[model samples]
Target: MDFWNRNRAKLAEKRRLRAARLQKKSNPSSAAEYQEKCKEASRTYNAKRLLAFKKREKRAEAAEVKHGRKEANRRQDQRETARDYKVEYELMKSGAEDAFRERVMHAMWNPAPGEYRIQFSDGSYKYFD
Candidate 1:
């Protein structure tokens, strides 16, 4: 064999010997000691798993509360918008905000063929031929 091959084989042998020595040193000698080690490892794993579950649950609760508030606020805004459009624009006497706004948008963007829509700075609009 070449010199390089011989050196490589020696290095591999040294590594194998080192691994064997480490395994022998760490090998548990007593049954009670082994059982203690296993129990400790199990306890550590269970604690970590419990901690992770708690964190996940806490995050879910926070997201639910945040999304719940958002939904409530959105509903309130829609009701207020519907009320204001009824009062301010004198557009319709009664309708949901969604329908009212859709009607307004359709009128604004797609007026009659010859009619033009104009928006003033004060939020009022007019239709003219």
Candidate 2:
């Protein structure tokens, strides 16, 4: 078995050498042609790779936009839901809230910019500006 393996390896090596010699026998022009062919093949491969990458990028961009739109819609929906809840709460608390507003509005006064005064229910007075 060892001999057989060694002999097989030798045969493969000889074949490889023979193929190399055959390739080296080409004239300079043929060599240049071979190089040009290799370059063209490489160019074609690179172009295909670039096209695939661009396609992936386009898909990614589209997904991002779709996700962004969904997020925007979600945020808007949340805001609307919150507003609806706020309206319901306000309607339930309308009398108390309105009374509080009136009391606060009557108690507090803004005489000027950055100036305010608060009036207590008592007759006592304090000045602030």
Candidate 1 Cα misplacement greater than 4 A, ranges:
1-29, 91-129
Q: Candidate 2: lDDT of 4?
A: 94
Model 2 over residues 23-112: C-alpha lDDT tens digits? 856667767777898899999999999999999999999999999999999999989866744553453345465654444333344667
lDDT of 1 by residue, 67-92 (tens): 99999999999898667554534443
Every model's Cα RMSD, please?
Answer: 8.4, 12.7
Using all chains and alpha carbons, the TM-scores for the candidates as numbered come to 0.52, 0.55
Candidate 1 lowest-lDDT run of ten: 86-95
lDDT of the candidates, in the order given: 0.69, 0.68
* Top-TM-score candidate index: 2
Task: Give the poorly placed runs of model 2, Cα more than 4 Å off.
Answer: 1-14, 95-129
